[model samples]
Target chain A: MEKRVTVLAGDGIGKEVTDAAVVVLEAVAKKYGHMFRFDHQLVGGAAVDAKNNPLPEETVASCEASDAILLGAVGGPKWDHNPPALRAEQGLLRLRKQFDLFANLRPVKAVSTLIQSSPLKEDIAKDVDMMIVRELTGGVYFGTPSLYNDEEAVDTMPYSRPEIERIVDKAFEIAMKRNKRITSVDKANVLATSRLWRQIVDEKKAQYPEVEVRHQLVDSVAMSIITSPKDFDVILTENMFGDILSDEASVITGSLGLLPSASIRSDGFGMYEPVHGTAPEIAGQNIANPAAAILSAAMMLTYSFDMLEEAQAIEDAVYGTFEDGYFTGDLTKDQPLGTKEWTEKVLQRLQA
Target chain B: MEKRVTVLAGDGIGKEVTDAAVVVLEAVAKKYGHMFRFDHQLVGGAAVDAKNNPLPEETVASCEASDAILLGAVGGPKWDHNPPALRAEQGLLRLRKQFDLFANLRPVKAVSTLIQSSPLKEDIAKDVDMMIVRELTGGVYFGTPSLYNDEEAVDTMPYSRPEIERIVDKAFEIAMKRNKRITSVDKANVLATSRLWRQIVDEKKAQYPEVEVRHQLVDSVAMSIITSPKDFDVILTENMFGDILSDEASVITGSLGLLPSASIRSDGFGMYEPVHGTAPEIAGQNIANPAAAILSAAMMLTYSFDMLEEAQAIEDAVYGTFEDGYFTGDLTKDQPLGTKEWTEKVLQRLQA
Candidate 1:
């Protein structure tokens, strides 16, 4: 297999974690007889410092030319005071829009040893393993006539049949790959968009009769997610609800640092990244966890490159490391391993 | 003090629980030397059965003429197949719109004895006592140009400066009345409505200089609420965000049956109700917990009637019952007291 990857190691600890991720990715490539060309690019504060643009044109060109993108993290206090247009965070948003990434996949799984660290009781947190499929680039966030002034403001939440069908179909596809159950979440009782969304979901269900479907009101599901997280297989929701529920699900695992996310277009092109932000305070400390970033690389391999076995190998290595009681500081109150040490352990496990 | 109270004991457990609430209310009136006139009215499935209207014109008129209203619950299996207009839940919406009830106040407190019942660990769920103030009758749920068909759909989330200000002011006032810290939730980075909402919250903070205010993006706050629930004093957000967060907060307490809510107009006219729905399965059974409904009557005393001492009496009595190891079935796995017996216990504690 041959793949070209764009690595946007944005700023602060992003550099450290992405470095760790690349090392693991190279190790995987060596273990699997594959060729991967790494294209290092400037983004966020680094890009602004170099070319006065948060998302340099050259970087986008490189990404467009690549098979997939692996982003470390973006933004820091260095560009916090910058105007909205020039802000480092805007670079990432522009990149997503530029690629037309429409579906965001967040997989949350409770680690067996880390269940004690969860805010939820062991009985509740231990059994939670679910994926949240969020519709990106549509609905209220991007709806037209979103006007705001000193007097009034408006944000439209619009969705067409095609938009709903694609996301619903994506969810069904993903669910078929995993647990074969889909919990389509919406505010059907209130929002017009939700009513149409439910209609589309029902239509999609008829096509994929093997995949069981359940429609839940957003409010009820929000509570249900917490009350009975293990009950869910694949949670499908619109943009705003997804933004809220994905973040909510992130905390459920008790290990936000280990979570990986993928944003992909209708085709195979995708961007993978760790769910956490740049920890400037911990930059250069070598203690930040690189598991999420590494797992993101694994996601890109499976989701973009069709390397399922290779991806599962990385996942197993990461899980096996935790099983052996090797963890980063975030996972435990006891002494923890540095980024290099953790990566080495995972690499050693991958070889075995 | 003399006041007219409209009691809408809608259907199923609504009748049982409201009966329990009225008994507590009459007891409070006897103890506090207040004159109270009760006007009972039909609503929900019962109203649909009698007058063939979910919210009858006479019921609306009675509610309009009263100083405040105490509602039990609404909706049941009997009216599940009715048309949208005649549906049992529509009656509640009509009443809220009729009263122009814009500010929704839901106070969530994790009971000390029932902390073990929560899905959250004791450390996380024990200290949770926060109030969520939601801006109802606005935002995407009621926004105009909300159209839907098989092809496409749209729901606008429009907010005027006045709409934001009133809700912000209401939150600040409520914060001043309780702990003087407010966490205003919005999605300012992406949503235009949130940006305007943040602007209004900032401007309102200038008026209540003593009330410390913090702006949180809705997604981050949703996670933080579960992670550090004790940190919140007052959680104020727009309609949909509030609907989700308030329900999320409700389950954090572990005893949803013990929570109460208020929907108020600017001038203190409000309707009080238990946060739990009418439990049709347990409707005629004497096992329903009346703690939430009784506490709702307490909210009416303080918020609508301005009888703080009387309200405190009801709250303290309920807490006292729990402290004495008196458990409702919803609160514990042990043998539990019936609704009437629990009401008698609360009344006994009030007189003591």
Candidate 2:
């Protein structure tokens, strides 16, 4: 089968990394005897400069038409001065809204070769691997009644039953794919939103008898992730909780550059991106790690196209690339390799 | 001068642990040559069993009359099924409202004796002695307009200028007391509540000229705390963020059973409590760790009454008790020290 992939080489190191990932993906397709058509698109700061719109209609159109969208990084100092509506981040946010990509799947796994890169004790970072399936679209971030008045301001955390049901179902389904334990993180002990969240999870638990659902207040879960991330398999949290927890999980693995995520909608449309932002300061220097972007390609193949074997091959190549102790500047362990060297190394591993 | 301390020894190991704290506090009074009188009050499930109300009118009156309040633990299976108004947790909630304790100071320190409890590698957990000065009263946790309409629900995160000002001011003040760096954690990129929180923090930062203030969105900070906790000195965040961050901070030490918190108001009144809950499963079994309760008393001495030396003494005693490779069943680290054994060891260290 032929897969139409839309590639958003966002800005700064984004273009470099995405280019690197595309080459790897192209190689994977040829090696696997599958056809993959790649469409390049503009987004974030790059799009802002080109068409005065971070997320132009053309980009969205291309993304919607494709089976999957692969993104590098977005936003830089150039777009920082832009208004929120026209900013590079807006492009990323708009895509999430347009695609109805409610579930954000961020997987943090420490490659054995890069275990020493982390500041954490080798014991903790060595065994640390978790999948944070965050609700991408709504919660306090996008809930209604969000207003700023003269004296007081209020942001509402509104959850429709359908919204809760869909996300919970997505989390449960994802949990089934990985380890069978699903830790549903919320603030049920205090917030009414949490009460509803817990209620829905309780209602949904019986449907997936194989997955053991543990309800933890968001705060406790946050601590648990840092203290005992090994105890968890799949963490399902609200938008804000997911955002915070996913980042925390990234740090545990010791490199924001190696982390990858998939923002997916129910119809299998997804935008794969690295969790890191565009580091414009290091852009031209070619010091940024491209592994996250490369790994995101792996996720895109698996989640968006259901190409498990191909995805695993990409993952294996990524690990294999670093097995001999080579990595980008962001790797920051004992010996740091430049971006070009790491990218070439990963590609070499793939060919081998 | 005389001090009136209201002691609410709620349930389970609460009474036993609080008793140990009471002994230490008495020792503190004697060492400091101060008059400290304790009026023990009922709360949590104990209050419901005795006066049929968690925060009884009489208890509230006594609490109102006290200089500061020391809580042991609240809630268990005993009051888990009770309505919100009658639940054991409600008692603590009511007290926070009554006292208007807007600043919840949770100090997370990896105790030298119990470093083995953390799931994180010792290197990562080593320098993680930071204070999470969370805005205890505002944001999504207590936001009104929170409702469950069977099919859907909404929770309002309302923050007034005063609420933001007080919490931010409190956080800065605490930062002045500890490290010179303050990381104000919020979701200013998204939430209006965070906008106000950031606005207030920006305003208040001007007054504390000596302290360096850094802003981090809630999501980023959540991940950062795990990956790079040592970099942070004072972390100031909103209620929901704090609730999660403080718990995450607790795990840096590897054991939630070893942390304690203080909820204080501007006028110097505060409630000291263990950051952990009443573990009813191990209640009356003499296996529960009394270390957290003891540490809370130490915090009460330092933060509440300015008895720094006495607080240091208690902390030293705790470190000494654990240093000898002796610990409670909850610690499960080096040696097997039951509740009584742990308490006795600390007492010996205190008297030494």
Candidate 3:
């Protein structure tokens, strides 16, 4: 199998982490007897510096032609002074719009070695392993009539049947592949969008009869996420709720820097990236952790390329690195390793 | 000073808990040399049964004529089959709108003795004592054009300058009285209403120069509530964000049954209630905890009546009840006492 991945090493630690991911992907390709190609494209702050635009037309074209996209991180204080339209983060939002990436998958697992690092009690936080599937394209963030007239402001949170259907179907499909329970979260007791969402989910339940489904109010889900995180297998929500909940879930794990996320359209195309932001402070330090970016590549292998064995191998190597007493500064209870050293340890485990 | 409080013991454990609150309030009045009057009224399912209305006109009139309102839990399974207009919870919503209660205060404190009750580790959850001030009347929930046309549904989250100013001022005023910091939560990066919200908060900051203000996106606050709850002093947010966050804050304490909340209008008129809902399953069991209801009375004394010493006395006695090896059925790590027995213990501590 051959895959072309557009690598957008945007700014700061973005370049360092993307480089680490590429190295890990090369090892996976060699070990699994596969052909892989990489296209380096400028985006975010790097693009603004080179092309005077956060997202160049050429970069978007390259990503469009690639089988998958791997983004490291984007934006920093240097670009913070820029106008909102020209800000580096706007480029990523535009990219999502270009691809119409409607579904965002964030898998938050409490890492065994770092369980003690979690803010939640060990008994409450330890067994949490769930996938949060969020509807990205439609919702309050992009809905019509969203503006302020100096005195008052209005933003619409709207959802159509088709939008709800596609996201709900994705959640069910993913739930069937893993655990059989899907928790559909919304404010059905109040919001019309949530009522429509619940209606569509109910209609789709007929098809996946074997899968168990439960509907939770958004407020209740927020509370439950902290109290009974172990009860969740797959959490399906709209854009804003997901934005809040996925981040909440990450914080509870106490391993925010090591989490990866994937945003994909209806088709198999996806752009994977670490959940962390560009750390301008650590850009050239060579001490940034690369595990999240590497794990994101693993997600791409499983989700986009259907290379389950290769994905599992990479995941095993990541778990092995931590178990073998290797740690990045962020995850260390003892000795800390640099990006290159951590990548080397993961690579050795992958080959074994 | 003399005060009249309209007491609406709505449904299920409402009667049991409100009865306990009255006993506690009476004890406080006698000890503190104040005259207190209680006016009983029917509401929720009980009102529905007797008057064919969830919130009878008589109930509203009684609340309007009183200096303040103290309500127990509302709604139960008995009213589950009722039409939307006749639902038990509507009574509470109608009352809030009737009084134009715009500011909601939910104080979530991690009880030191019940530190083990929280889902978060003792180190993270031990010192959490934050007040969440929510804008209740305005936002997406009640904003105009909140409807569905089968294909698409929309709810507008609109905020006027006055709404923002009032809530921000309330938060700052409360912050000045407690800790000197306020964290205003919004989605300014994404939502237009939030941008306006930030603008108003900034304008109001000049008046309360003594209070340090910080801005955080709602998503970040959700995560931080779980990761670093002890860092928060006051959290100010709009309706929907507050609805979600207050519940999330409640769960982290693992004492949802023991938390009290207050919804206040501009002119010092307010309604105090337990954060817990009526448990129909345990309605007549006498096993429900009365701590939250008793604490709600404490809030009424401090917030509406301005009887600080009386409020402190009630608060201390409640805490003393917990500290002196008396445990209610719900909060018991060892011995469990019934509601009546727990109320007697609290009363005994109050008189001591």
Candidate 4:
């Protein structure tokens, strides 16, 4: 199974880490009798510097032609002064917009072996595994009345019938694949957007009788995610709420560098990436973790294409690495590894 | 010092816990040589039962005449079917509006002993002593255009020049009183509400020359608070954002049962209460934890009456109890203390 992968090693440590992940992907391909082809494309600040376009047409074409796209980190202090349209982050936003990736799957699971490193007590974080299915491209972030006049400004939290219909349906469908429990998070008590969200969720509930649906306020859900992540299964919320909650959920897992997300469209074209930003200060140091990017490769294979066995192989390798206490600086303070060592360890585990 | 305290222990656990808190406060008064007088009023479902209004005129009058108000948790499942206007939460909102309580201060800190009970890893939870200074009266909750017009619905996230100014000022003032570091949490990258929030905070930064002001998106801050809670000092956000973030922050500290909040007006009047709601199931049972309600009594003494030493004494006593691992069921799985016993413990510690 030789896959044509477009790697957007965007900027800063993205180049180093993505390069490391590429090496691992090649090793996995060899170990499994598969073809893993790589096509590099410019994005983020690099794209801005090259073509004055953060997400150039060539990059989009490359992604469109490939089976899946893997992006390294985007944005940095260099593009801090750039206008919104030309900024490094615009590349990510544009890429997300271009794909129409409706559902963002962020799995927050405490690497059980590394639970001692978590800021939370061992009992609460131990054995905690949950996936946050956040609805992308809608709600407050894209809502209207997002108007600015001479003096006053407004940002509307709007949700159309179809928008709520698809996201909630996606969430329920995702929930069906998980613990069979779905916690629909919203601000229904205050925001009309949430009331619509809850209404749609209620309507969609009858279709998936096997899945349990419970509604909680965004605030309460945010607190619950931290207080007791073990109590939750799949947390489905709107765009902005998901943006906030997913990141918060990422923290308690004690593995920011190992987390991966898949933003896929209904028709299957998707962008996979690590959740962290470009740490320019760590660029060229070879100390940045590559596991998240590598895990993203696994997600791309599992989701964008149908290769569950390969995905499992990568995930198992990650678990094995954590079990051995071989980690990048971000994961462990004492047994830190450089990018090459971590990548080699994971690939070596894959072979074993 | 004789202090006039109004007790509005409205509905369910409110009655029992308030009774327990009253016993504790009285003990403190006798121990501290502070003369105190008490006034009782009906609100929430209790008020509807007595006067057909969630916040009756008599109750409002009683609260207004008192030096400071101490409230029990309000609302329960019995009132769940009531219209929004007749709900137990409305009485609390009414009190906020009646007293013009525009600022809400919630201190979120994980107890050294109770940290084991939290889902967060112990390292992240260790030094999370942060105060969330929220603008209580403004933002999406009470903003204009917050009504359902026909099948179409609307809610506003509105703020004015003075509204932002005052809240930012209050946050900075509180920062001066605490760690002298202030984080203004908003969504400037997306929402105009946050854009205005950032502008005001930027303008106010000059006034607080010594106060270090940092601006962060609400989503990132939410994640940071959980993953590295010790990094923050004071979090300042608008009404709805505050409501969400503060509640999220509270959970990091372990139990909502141990957290207290103060809602105050610029003029001086304050309404202090535990952040948790009425637990209808625990209403008749004597096992409800009274530490939060008791702590609310401490806040009432300091913030409302300018009795700082008294407040510190109450706080120290509460901490000493937790520091010794003397906790209620909410903190850990133990032979849980009943409400009466928990109240007695904190009051007894005040003497030591």
Candidate 5:
């Protein structure tokens, strides 16, 4: 099998991490007897500096020609003063819009080695492994007539049946691959959009009869996320609720630097990235954790290339490195490994 | 001093808990040398059973004539089959609408003795004494043209300057009373209403120069509530965000039975109630916890009547009772006190 991947090493620590992911992916390709071609593209702050555009046309063309895209991180304080269109983060947003990447998958799994660092008690955070499927493109953030003046402001939350159906279908498909349970979250009693969201979930469930479904109010789910996170399998929510909840779920793992996310469309085309952002202060230090970036490559393998075993191998190797007491600067104060050294350890474990 | 208190012991354990609160209020009245008159009224399922209305006209009249209202939990499975207007919870919603109770106050404090019961680790859960002031009457919950059909649904989130100003002022006032710091939560970068909300907070800061203020995104605040709850003093947000966050904050303490809430207008006229709902299964039993109802009365003393010292006395006594190992069934399983017995213990501590 062969795959062409676009590598967007945006700026700062993004360069370090994406370089690390490419090395890991090369090792995986060698071991699995697959042809993996990498196309490097400048984006975000780097693109803005060199080409005066946050998302350059050549970069988009390379991404359009690739099977999957792996991004490290985007934006920095240097570009913070730029106008909205020129902002570094706008590059990633535009890419998502261009690809119609409507479903965002954020998987929060409490690593046993990092459980003590979690804010939640060990007993509560120990077995929390859930996937949050968020509809990325629709809802309040993009709803029209969202205008404001000195006296008043109004933002709309709009959801059509087709939009709700596609996301719900994605959640159901993800649920079938995991624990076969989906918790559809919304404020059905109050918001018409939520009611429509719930209705779509109910209609879609008939198609996936083997997968169990439960409807929960957003508020109730928020409480349960902390108290009984183990009860959820796949949490499906609209844009705004998903934005809040996915972020909330990320913290329970304690190691933000170890989390990976994917934004994909129906055809399994995806852009994978680490949940952490660009660490400008630690950019060239060779000290930033690359676990999340490597795992994001793993997600790309599974979701975009349909290489489940290769994905699992990468995931296990990453976790095994932590289990073997290899620490990154973000996760420990004692004897931390450099980005290159940590990827080396993961590679040794992957080959072992 | 003289005061008229309207008590609505709506349904289930609402009757028992409200009865316990009355005993505590009577004791406080005697000790403080205040003339207190109590007017009892029906408002929820009980109102539906007796008067064929969830909120009877007479109940409204009684509430209007009173200086402040103390309500028990409302709603029960028995009324779940009723039409929307006839539902038991509608009574409470109508009351808030009737009084224009724009501000909903939910205070979350980690009690020392019960800290072990929290889902959060002891260090994270300890010192979590924050007040959440929510704008109740506006935002998406009650926005106009919240229409849904087979194809699409739309809900608006609208906030006028005056609406934001009043809620921000209330939050500032509450901040001045407590820690003199406020964390205003919004999604200003995306939502137009949130941008206006942030603007209002900035404008209102001039009037509250002594109170320190910080702006936070709603998603960041949600994570912070669990990661570093002690960092917040007053968390002010719009209706839907507040609903999700207050509920999230509630679970960290692990003692939902002890939490109290208040909905108030600008003039300090308010309705106080326990955050817990009507536990119909436990109704007419002596096992219900009345700590929340008793605390609601304390909130009434401070907010509605401006009896700060008297409010402190009630608060201290309740905590003192718990510290002395007098456990209610909700807080403990071994040798738990009955509803009446717990109230007696609180009363004994108050008198001491």
Candidate 6:
């Protein structure tokens, strides 16, 4: 099998981590006997410096022609004074809009080796492995008539049946692949959009009869996430609730630097990236952790390319490196491995 | 000094806890030499059973005539099947609407004696004594044109200058009384209402120059609540964000049975209640924990009556009872105190 991938190594540490992930991807391809073509494109601060546009036409064209896109990180203080349209984050947002990437999958699994670093008690954080499926493009964030003046301000939260249906369907599909349990979260009793959201989930439940489903209020789920995170499988929520919850879930493991995320459409076309951002201070230092970026490549392999076994192999190799007592600067104060050295450790395991 | 207090011992263990709180209030009044008048009113399922209305007209009248109101807990499974308007929770909502209780205050403090029960590590939960002030009557929860049909649903989040001003002022005033620091939370970068909310907080900051203020995005604040809860003094947010965050903050202490909340107007008139709900299974049993209800009375003394010293006295006594290794069934497994026994312990400390 052959697949063309777009690599948008945006800026700063983005290049270093993406390079590390590409090395891992190349190793995976060699071992699995697959042809993988890489197309590098400019985006974010780097694109703004070169083309004066954070998202250039050529970059979009390359991504549109690819099977999957893997982004490193975007933004730096140097471009902080730029207008909204010229900003680094706007590039990623526009790409999502362009591809209609409506579902954001953030899977937070507490690594056994890092359990002691978790804010939650070891007993509570030990077995917390859940996927948070966030509806990325709809709801309050993009709802129309978001206007404000000196006297008043208003933002709308609008959800149509089609929008809710697509995301709920994605959650159900993901649930079917994993634990077959879905916790649909909303404020159904208050907001009309949430009521519609809940209704759509109920309708979708009938189509996937084998998957167990339960509805929870946003507030109740917030408490439950901390009190009993092991109880959840796939947490499906609208844009704003998902935004807050996904971020909240990110911190429990205390391994923010090693979490990966994917924003994909229904057709499995996705842009994968590390949950961490550009570390401008550590740019080109060869010291930033590349585990998240490597894991993101693993996600793209599974979600976009349907190479589940290869993805599992890459994941096991990454975790095995940590289990073998290797450390990154972010994860430890003791002898830490450089970006290149850490990727070497993972590669050695994969090759062996 | 003289004050009239209205007590709404709603249902289930509500009567027992409120009765326990009333006993503490009586003891405080006797020690402080204050003339206190107590008036009992019916609400929730109790009101529904007696008057066929969850919030009876007479109950509202009594609350209006009182200087402050203390609610135990409301709603039980017996009323779970009732119509929407007749539900037990509606009574509490109507009461808030009737009194224009726009600011909901929930304070979470990790007690030294109970620190071991926190879900977070001891160091992270040790100094978590933050107050969350939520805007209750505005935002998406009660916004206009909240309509949904087969195709689409929409809910407006509108905030007027006056609405934001009052809540911000309340938060600032509370900050002045506490640690003199406030963290105003909003999603200013994306939502128009949040931008306006931030503007109002900034505008009000000049009026209270002694108070230190900072603006935080709602998502970031959610993560911070768990990662570094001790960093916050007062968290001010809109209705929905508050609902989710306040609940999230509640579980970190792992002492849900001992948290208190308040819904107040700008003029200081307020209704106090425990953060815990009506536990129908524990109803008519003398083993229910009354710590939260007792704490609500403490909040009433400080906020409604301006009896700060008297409030501190009650607080110290309650903590002292716990420090002495006494606890209700909810907090212990070894020879737990009954409701009356716990109240007696608190009373003993108050008298001492």
| Residue B95 accuracy (lDDT) in model 1 | 91
- Top lDDT hit: 6
Give the chain B TM-score achieved by candidate 2: 0.94
| Candidate 1 residue-wise lDDT, B1-352, digit = tens | 8999999999878888888888888988999899889999999888999999999999999998999999999998889999888899988999999999999999998888888888888999896889999999898898889999889999989999888888898899889888899999999988899999999899888899999999999999989878999999999999999999988888986888889999998899999999889998988889899999999999999889989899999999998899899977776678799988888999999888
- Note the residue pairs that clash in candidate 5: none
Candidate 4, position A120, lDDT:
70
On the 0 to 100 scale, the lDDT of residue A16 in model 4 is 84
TM-score of model 1 (CA atoms): 0.98
Q: Which candidate achieves the best DockQ against the true structure?
A: 6
Question: Which run of 10 residues does model 5 chain A get worst, by summed lDDT?
Answer: A248-257
Better of 3 and 5 by DockQ: 5
Residues A76-105 of candidate 1 have per-residue lDDT tens digits of 998999988889998899999999889899
**Predicted candidate 4 versus true structure: per-residue lDDT over A1-352, tens digit per residue:** 7678899999999998789778877877887788978899999999999999999999999988887888899999999899888999999989888878888989888888777766677777778778888889876677667764334566666567777677777777667757899999988777877787788889889999999989998888887877778999989888888888888888775777678888987766688998878999989998998878888888887777767787889889988888888988876689689999888888888989
Decoy 4 TM-score against native: 0.90
Residue B148 lDDT, candidate 4, scale 0-100: 53
Show the colliding residue pairs in model 3.
none
Alpha carbon lDDT of residue A183, candidate 4?
Answer: 90
Off by over 4 Å in 6: none
lDDT measured at residue A185 in model 4 versus the true structure, 0 to 100: 90
lDDT per residue (tens digit) for residues B1-352 in model 4: 8878889998878887778778767877887787889899998988877787899998888887888888987787777788888887799988988788898999887778777656666676777889898998876666666655224455677777777787788788778877899989988878887887788788889988999999998888887887778989999988877888988888776666788889987766788888887887777788777888888888787777777787788888888887877767666577777777777788778776
Q: Write the per-residue lDDT of candidate 3 for residues B249-291, one digit (tens) a residue.
A: 9988777788999999778899999998898888878899999
CA RMSD, predictions in order: 1.4, 2.9, 1.5, 3.2, 0.9, 0.9
* Model 2: how far residue A341 lies from native, Å: 5.3
Tell me which of candidates 2 and 4 scores higher on TM-score. 2
lDDT of 2 at A259: 83
Candidate 1's error at B120, in angstroms? 0.7
Q: Which CAPRI tier for candidate 2?
A: medium
Task: Tell me how candidate 4 scores on lDDT.
Answer: 0.82
